[model samples]
Target: MPSGPSFLKKFTSLILSFGPGIFAIGYTIGTGSVTSMIVAGSTHGMQLLWVLLLSCLFSGILIYVYGNYTLLTGETALFAFKRHLKWGRVMAILIIIGIAIGQWNSLMGIMGISSNIIYEIFAIYFPGISSFKYEAVITIALVLTAVFYALLLVGRYTFFEKILVVFVTIMGVSFLISLFMVYPLPEDVIKGLVPSIPQVKGGRMLVAAFVGTTMAAATFLSRPLFVKGKGWTINNLKEQKKDAIVAAILVFVISGAIMAVATGALFYEGKPVTQVLDMVNTLEPVAGKFALTLFFFGTLSAGLSSIFPILLIVPILIADYQSGQLDTNSKQFKRITAFACLFALIVPIFGSNPVEMQILSQIFNVFVLPLVILGILLLINKKSIVQVHKTHFLLNIGLGLALLFACIISYNGVKALIDYF
Candidate 1:
C-alpha cells in the first residue's frame, strides 16, 4: 500500500473535484430543509424515507442530465432555452421568474431561522438574551448579511465553492457525530426503503414537500453553471458524473442523519419541532449537552452555507439568462447581491412564520419543476444541438419519469398550500 501522505493526497484530489456537488449540498440543505426533515422524522418516523430516497435518486439523474448538456454544448440552461427551442423566450422568462421568486422567498426564511439560531445559542449561555429576542435576531441577521456580502465582493466562484466545502464538511461531520450518539432502529430505517407514505391527513402534502425540497429546480438548473464555473467540459464527463453521485449521496446521508436523529430523539418521546430550540432541547434529554451542541453547530453550518448561494442565485441566473459567464466583478452582479441581501432582512425585521414561508417556497418550487424538466428534455434530445452526444433512451426515460413526478408533486403541493391557508 502507498504511504499515508500519498493516500491523503489522492483523497484530497477526489474531494476537490467534487466542488460543484459539495456546493449543491450546502445550497440544498438550508434551515428550511432541516425543519422539514426533522418534522418528518418526529411526526412519521422513517416512513417518509422513501420520499427522500426517490427525490435524491432523481436529483442525481437530473444533475447529470443538466450538467451533461452544458458539458456537451458549452451553453447554460436558460440561454439554451431562450436561444434554441420554439417559444424559448417565454419559457426562459417564466423559469427565471419562477425560480427567482421561490429562491428569494426561501432566503427570507433562511435568514430568519439562522438569525434565531444565533439568538438561541446566545440565550443558552446567557439567559438575559432571551428577553431581547427580536433585537438580538435582527442584529445577528444584519451582521451575517453584511459579512456574507463582503465575502461575495471579495471572492469569485472558486472562493465561494471553497467556503461551502468548509460549511458542508462541518455540517456533515456534526450530524454524523450526533447520529452515532443517538440512532433509530435499523429495522425502522430498513422499512423506509419499501416506499410508503403516512396515512395522516397532510401526509400527501408532506411527501410532496419532501420531493420539493430534495428535487429542487434550483439544484438541477444551477448545476450547469457550477460545472462550467469549475472549468469542466465534456472531457470531464466522468468527474461530472462522480460529482453528481457524491452530491446526491451526501444529500441523502445528511438528510437521513437528521431524520434518524429526530426519530430516535423526538419521535419515541413524542416531542414537537415547531422551533429551532425544539430539536435542540429534544437532543439534550437523549444525549446531553455535547449532542445538543453538535446539532446546533450542524444547523448553523447548514444556514450559513445556504446564505452564500442564496445571495448568488439572482446574479447567477441573470448571468445564465445572457449566457454562462458570471462576472462577479460586474456592476450587475454587485447590484443583484445587494438587492437579495435587502430581501433577506424582511423576515428578521418583521417576524414572519418560518414554517409558512417554508411551505410557500416549496409550493413555488414544486410548481416550476415540471417546466424545468420539460425544457431540458427538449434540449438534451435535440440532435442539432447535442450532435452525437444526444441523450440515450434510458436517460430520456428517466427524464420522462422525472417530469411525471414533478407534475404529481406540484398538484399535491398546491393542495397543501390551499389547506395551509
Candidate 2:
C-alpha cells in the first residue's frame, strides 16, 4: 500500500512515539536493580533468581496497564485519580506524598551508592588520594544536578526524549560489556534460571529483603509520569503496548545480567556485601577495576538521570493538589523543586544508614503499590474514560495478585522494622 522508504519512516516514527515507557524503565532499573542484584548474589547466591524474573514480569504488566490507562484517560495517574476519584483525594494525596518522599530517599541512596562505587574505583587506580573521595562525590553531584536542571529548563520535549534514548543505549551497552567481561560459568549460571527459594541463615529477613529488592514499589508507581510525558492519547493503545513490551524486556535483560554478574563474581568468593559498594569491590577480581568503573558510571547515569523527573514530579503533585491546577512554569513548580532539593540534601545530613533508608523506603513503597494499582485499575475502567478498554478479567487477577504479594511483603517488612527498633 505504500513505498518502502515511506513505510519505513512511518514505522520509525511509531517506534519513537514509545519514548516515555523506555524512560520509565530507566528509573526502575537504576540503583534499585543494583541493590537487588547485589542482594540476590551476595546473600543467597542466586537462590532468589526467580524473584528477579517474576518481579520483572509483574512490573512489566503493571507498567503497561498504567500506560494504557493514562492514554485512555488523557491524564496522568495523579490527575486522573484526583479528578475522577474526588472522594478519595485525601488518601490519594497521602499516597502521592509517600511516593515523593520515597523518590527523594531513593535519589539519596543512589547518590551514596554511586559515590561509593566511584570512590572505590578511584582508590584502585590512583592508589594514594583517599582524601579526594568526598570532594569527588560533591563535585559529581553538583555537575549532574546542573546538567539535569538545564535539560528540563530548556523545555524541549525532544531533548528529554533524546536524553532518555542515549541513557538507555548506555545502559544496554554497559551491561553487555560487564556480562561479557565477567565470563561467568555457563552451567552454574544456567542453574540460576530454575526458580527456588534460598535457605538464608537469617531466613525471613533475607526473604523480605529479596522481595524489597525485586518488587521496587516506587519504581512501579513512577511509570505514570513517563507515560504522560509522551502525550499519548486513547488512540495510541497499540503503539503504547509495543513500547511497554520493548521496555519491559529490556528491564528484564539488563537486571538479569546484573544478577548473573554478581552471582558469578561474588557468590564464588563467599563475599559479604551489605551495600552496593561491596558489590563493586566484589567485581574487582573478575571484571577488573576498569569494568567496575564502567559499572559505577552506569549506576550513576541511571540514578542521576532519574533525579530531574523525580524532583519535578514531587512539586508538580503538591501544586496540582492545593491549587487544582497544572502549570509547569509557575511559582509552585519552583517551590516544589526547592523542597525536593532540600529533601535530597537533608537525608545525607541525618547520618542515617543510606542502605537501610533505601530498604525502609522500599518497604513503605510495597504498602503503597496495592493502593496505587487499585486506583489505576478503578480509574481506567470508568465509563468516562475508555469504558471499552476496561481491564479484562485476567488483568484484574494479575493486579489482585500483585496486591496480594505487596500485602505479604508489607507485613514482613513491618515485622523486620519492629525487630530493628
Candidate 3:
C-alpha cells in the first residue's frame, strides 16, 4: 500500500476511468443479488454456480452490444428501438413500463434489505435493540431514502458514479476478506461448474433470480445511457469493451465469493438462509464477529449503491424514450426520482421478508429478458440502420444463444411464479 495521499490518489485513479461498468456493477450486484446468492449457496451449496457463470458471460456480451450501439449510431437503446424498428414505439413504451415496474419492485427489496441489515448489525452489537427491530429498520430506511434523494437533487451523473465507485470498492474489499476467511472446498467449487439444477423447492426461481439479477435487462438497456453520459464514441470502442469486461468479471468474482463464503460457513452445517440474519450468521465460527461486521458492511454498501441507481433508473429510461439527451437537473428527472425514493419506503416499513421479496423482484426481471434480448438482436442485425457496423457472425451467434437462454429462463421464471402462488 502506498502511503497516505498517494494511496488515496492511486485508488481514485484506478476506478475513475471504469465509470460506466462500475455503475452497472453498482446497480446489479446489490443486496437483492447478495441475498439471492446467499440463499442459493446455503441451500444448494455450489450446485448453481453454473447459473452465475453463464449469467456473467451473457452479461458481458449484452453490455458490449448495447454500449457498441451507442458508439456506432450515437443513439440510446430506447431511441434506437423507436427510430429503426416498426411497432418500436409501442415496444419502447412497454419496455419503459415493464422495466420501471420491475426496478421499482427491486428498490423495495434493496431498501428493506439494507435497513434490515443495519438492524441486524445493531442487534449484534447492543443485543437490546432487538425489541426496536421494526422501528430501527424503518428509521434507517427513511434516513437512507432522504439522503439518496438529496444526493439526486444536488449531484450530477458523474457525482453519482463517483459515489458508487466508493461503494463498489468497499463491498469488493469486504467480501474478498470474508471469502478468504471462509472459502469452500475446491472439489465442490469445481463440481459447480458442471451444471446441475437442484430438485428442491424454490430452486428454479433461484436459477431465474441468479440469471435475472446478473443478466438484467435494465443493465443492457441502460448501458447506452451510461455510455453516452461518459461521452464515448466509435473511437472508444475498445475502452468500452474493456469496461464491460471489468463489470462482468467483478460481478462474477464478488458474487461468487459471497456464494462460496456461504457454502463453506453455512451449507456444511445444514443451515438455510431465509433472511438477512441467516446471512449474517453464515460467517459465524470460522470467521467470527469481525468478519460478520465486514460482511454486513458489504451488504449495506451493496444496498446503498443499488438504491441510488434504482431510484434514478426510471428517469434515465424515460429520458431515453423522449430524447437521447439526459438532463439530470430537469424537473422530470427530479420528480420521478423523488417519487421513486418515496415509494421505496413501503417495503421496509411493512414488509415481512425482504429476502423473499428480493428474490421475487429479481425473478420478475427475467420475464422481460426475452423481449429485451430479441429487440437488441433485431436492431443489431438490421443492415439499413447499422450499415457497415452490422453485428458480425460470432457476435450474432452469441446473441442467438443469449436469446435462447433468455427464453428458457423466462419460462422458468413464469413456472416458478405459478408454483410459488
TM-score of each: 0.95, 0.84, 0.97
Which candidate do you rate higher for TM-score, 1 or 3? 3
TM-score winner: 3
Error of 3 at 95 (Å): 1.3
Off by over 4 Å in 3: 1-8
Best candidate, lDDT: 3
Local lDDT at 305 for model 3: 85
Model 1: residue 292 alpha-carbon error in angstroms: 1.0
TM-score head-to-head 1 vs 2, winner: 1
Give the per-residue lDDT digits (tens) of candidate 1, residues 1-421: 6689899898777666665897779777877677788888888888888888888988989988888888889988888998999988888788878888888888898888888888888888999988888899999999999999999997578988888888888898899999998789999999988878777767777777688778888888788888988899889998898888988999999999999988998888888576666766777878788988898899889989888987887788788888667557788989999999999899889999775576467667777888889999999888899998857899999889989988888888887777766
Question: By lDDT, is 1 or 2 better?
Answer: 1
For candidate 2, lDDT tens digit of each residue in 170-287?
Answer: 7667776877776447776667668665554444454565555455555545455555555667677887788777777878777777777677677778885676556655777777
Q: Give the local distance difference test score of model 1.
A: 0.84
Order of candidate numbers by lDDT, starting with the best: 3, 1, 2
| Candidate 2 least-lDDT 10 residues | 319-328
lDDT score at residue 105, model 3, on the 0-100 scale: 88
For each predicted model, how many residue pairs clash, with residues at least 3 apart or on different chains? 0, 0, 0
Ranking by TM-score: 3, 1, 2
Report the Cα lDDT for residue 130, model 3. Answer: 84
